[model samples]
Target: MSKKILLSWLFMAILCLPVFAQIQEPVKFKTEWKSVSADEVEIVFTGKMEKGWHVYSTDLPEGGPISATFNTDKLEGAEVVGKLKPAGKEIDKMDPIFGMQVRFFEGTATFVQKIKLKGGKYEVSGYLQYGACNDENCLPPTNVEFSFKGEAAGKQTAEEVVATTEDLALADTASVDLVPLRIGEDTAAGEAADYWKPVIKELSSFGENVNNESHSWIYIFFAGFVGGLLALFTPCVWPIIPMTVSFFLKRTKDKRKGIRDAWTYGASIVVIYVTLGLAITLIFGASALNDLSTSAVFNILFFLMLVVFAASFFGAFEITLPSKWSNAVDSKAEQTTGLLSIFLMAFTLSLVSFSCTGPIIGFLLVEVSTSESIVAPAIGMLGFAIALALPFTLFALFPSWLKSMPKSGGWMNVIKVTLGFLELAFALKFLSVADLAYGWRLLDRETFLALWIVIFALLGMYLLGKIKFPHDDDDTKVSVPRFFMALASLAFAVYMVPGLWGAPLKAVSAFAPPMQTQDFNLYKNEVHAKFNDFDAGMEYARQQGKPVMIDFTGYGCVNCRKMELAVWTDPTVSKLLNEDYVLITLYVDEKTKLPEPVKVMENGTERTLRTVGDKWSYLQRSKFGANAQPFYVLLDNEGMPLNKSYSYDEDIQKYVEFLQTGLKNYKR
Candidate 1:
């Protein structure tokens, strides 16, 4: 029950944790050599061992440590021309831990090598890599550096031959040199290479595409919280609280009854959201949810769905249940038929608060779909319920506290206006989808920056009473939140102003367009780029020596935004994108107009391509049989799929595995 006791138990549990009786040692590489015959120097890679564990046999099909690899230093007089043969025997059978026979080892395994010597001495260097695993966990294979001396025949007596060790050679375990996205480059002028080049390199190698399947619950819970927060801020919801509490007091004139109803209302909110979350989880199983997250079609649909919600946020219109449904819910609430009325009251609360909570709910639901955890949506709803229900319970406990919150006034309108700006800011994510779908590239890097600048600038002006909406209440002075908001908006707008001219805007780069597309000045300094265009990126994917990593991304994809924040920023994974693979970022919801003759069918719906997004959407839905951004398709140099396509999520490990599998598959 106590923290200390719990921690002690946890530590003890870890200490006695059932293990596969594996050995683990700080990966160390040592060197040794011997004469196999007259003219050959044989290198013996005796990877030192740590007690209690064994390195896995490299010949693992189902599970085991990775194979130990040996490479030779570019030696002048010596060359390695034979395959590495380890001194071990293969044993495959059903094991207790592994349902299938898994490759494993005990103590140390030696990889024997024979190198023919020509005339002189030379140093050969490379790495020996193999994963070591206990019954509980597997440490990823890492290369330990080892080297050996090759001498001309008769140069040294057999007695002179001695074993030696060397410092660990850096193994390419998730090794990616992330050059930040930049302009111009030359390895020759090392001192002043285009700074942006390094930056681009970094951006290109944005690390581990998350799998998110496991953390579905976290996303769902977060969505619920966002919904509850939005519900709290709504004009209608905020005003009703005091009125409802007053009604409860006046109706019964009993403080206890008033408290009871307030608690009931809050509990009702929690029940409603939790039920909704549970219902969704029940309807969609984990595997289905995984499909939706990775499915390109679902992604496009989600992107479009967000656009619809954004439109609603911008006063386009309201999407609601039937009028009769609301009336029925209201009628039930008014009936006062026992505690049932409270439940009805909660239902009515949801209906009435729909205008405010609708977007948030939509956003939350879309997010939960990716989690693939049955409870994720429910968890999200729980978070939302807590945020919404907290105020009611807290306020009822201290009625006097109601007086402290500013009386509902023009400030409420200020809140709405501020939310409107956020709505617009989020709207661009949808447009970005269309931008990427079609090849127009209309909403390029700098353009995205400008729109953000304008949106925030307008928000700043509105805060200063320079702008008003149709529903705005005329107010001469800004309130506490409004003033702070205005300052934030103004400063943020100012921060982006330079981006239009070509600033890297690292502060906001994750959310902004790729640096290659920005037109800017400092921080991301560049000598106007001569980089190839989007078409070239695709061609490069096909022509390059390495494979292509096709990123089906959209501007308005919320999960795509999340993926950037959660996954791509990981340093270990980002380097792979920047270096080994050619990245083709395709936007599926581009809004730019097509030149001509762009017609297509998507989901059996016939359409003409007026915008770039249309074509891209069509391509994804039709050609690729996918409709998701954050969809990754690994392809060989010839543009054929090396492995099955994978979708995005919060699990970086699975994503890394997918990438690793693709590379391994191709190498085989």
Candidate 2:
């Protein structure tokens, strides 16, 4: 009975884990008002936050979290005596999420507002707004409303207490309910417009027919598999393959037993790497992974780390774990028996081959962690491990294949050196992100293109034996395979030469700096969005009777630039967007401040949109339930989606079909 009870408890715990992860509210509040004197009253708002979560102080600067504020709608027969002030233990420090200095409060917070009451009955009601965040995620700004009704410096008779409906001035609108404002509606009485409507439910039906989740996972897996295949050619991993297999074969007299052990060894590799991926996700969380990948400080660190790895691959030095660690793992494998021994052996290989595989794994994580999927890192590692482990099991099953395998030679070092060049070139991309974010202008388009051109050209020269590295063999000659690789590299370098003069290199647009950064430009043909404001664009589309194409993009989004350069540049797409549809490009990362902040009620929480980017971002989330960039949706004049939305696809024909579908729906 006890065992059954334990099993039931474990099952319920597993089910509850997901429910806990979905909880977004971390702070709770209560409010009270007290009479301080015959003519004075104090309103106190107290908040208790969850552990490790904090609310930003009332004095944070613009561009950070929304500072705490007291909003008032009605304060009849009373005037605020002083500013709303906070009484709590406040913390001031630099915040990594906003990349600036901020002040916040944790645990408990108290805010007091003093009001002087006129000599009559009075009423006061309003809401308090603030933003909260933890290390991993930031919640939308939230509001807590308060109301007080009392009489001050007056003794009312029984007849006076029995007042008419007009004398009992109640709130016109409920605190929780919002007055919906239609698009292009006039407000003669000065009612605020409801900009963020709950359009997500209506938009769901339009996109229900389209699904890209499985395709995205497959793509990431294939990329990691290719990286694993490349690592197999490195000198460190290739030579060890034979030696590790031989050890497994000699350990057991029975060939079947040896093959089974090899299978276990391969499985162990997968488990180790996948666990590492899971550890990363569990430690930093999905939201933090996105933040870390795009952070300027993280990019700079990644840039420096990649440069060091590239130098190691160039034979400047070796990057490896301590000898004692590998020795200890190897010793454990020899001492242990059965499955444990196999896992230890696999671990030993992982430690020993770190110098070759570490860079590949690091680069793969950096690329995939930008995605919103929490399991992306683990899925990528799973694919990589499977590819890396395939040969061991295959060779064990067919020993004759080992004799046919190519002998390790100077060619292995050649592949490593080529990878070094690629790493060196890719390292600049991270630095470019940081440069663009900080407006440093250090690696502009022309300068970035010049460096890439030189790197690929030098790589081509190295492949043709025109240059020598520290580990290169003196007798290295241009073989057929090497010759073709050199040809391709030289061609790629020539292709990018046009980019230095402002030509968009569509093939490398995903990696190269944007064309706007280039000083010189010869390319004149490019598609431009008609409007950046959502309401203005929708109004124009309504007047023209054209469908609306809203392009949700960002400055730092790599795939958005890829689609723009690759598909939007096509004549057909350009013409369709320019003529048949009203194009609206909303940049979610744009930092320009709005003329005046707008109050929006989204997901039952009030959010303050203080910047242009914040307004667009709120529109995307409240309207479509998506926050990723390069999101394209076609809507009618009423702002209802006409067709399935599109995201990050570079196929020009499919994009054309998407636009046509929306146009067809609109005409009907």
| Candidate 2 residue-pair clash tally | 0
Best by TM-score: 2
Question: Deviation in angstroms for 591 in model 2?
Answer: 14
Q: Please, what is the TM-score per model? A: 0.49, 0.67
Query: What's the distance in Å from true for residue 148, model 1?
Result: 33
Worst 10 residues of 1 by lDDT: 195-204
**In terms of TM-score, how similar is model 2 to the real structure?**
0.67
lDDT of 2 by residue, 200-239 (tens): 5455566442323322788889978988888889998999
Residue 221's lDDT in candidate 1: 68
Off by over 4 Å in 2: 1-220, 250-253, 278-298, 331-337, 365-378, 432-441, 444-446, 494-570, 583-642, 645-653, 665-668
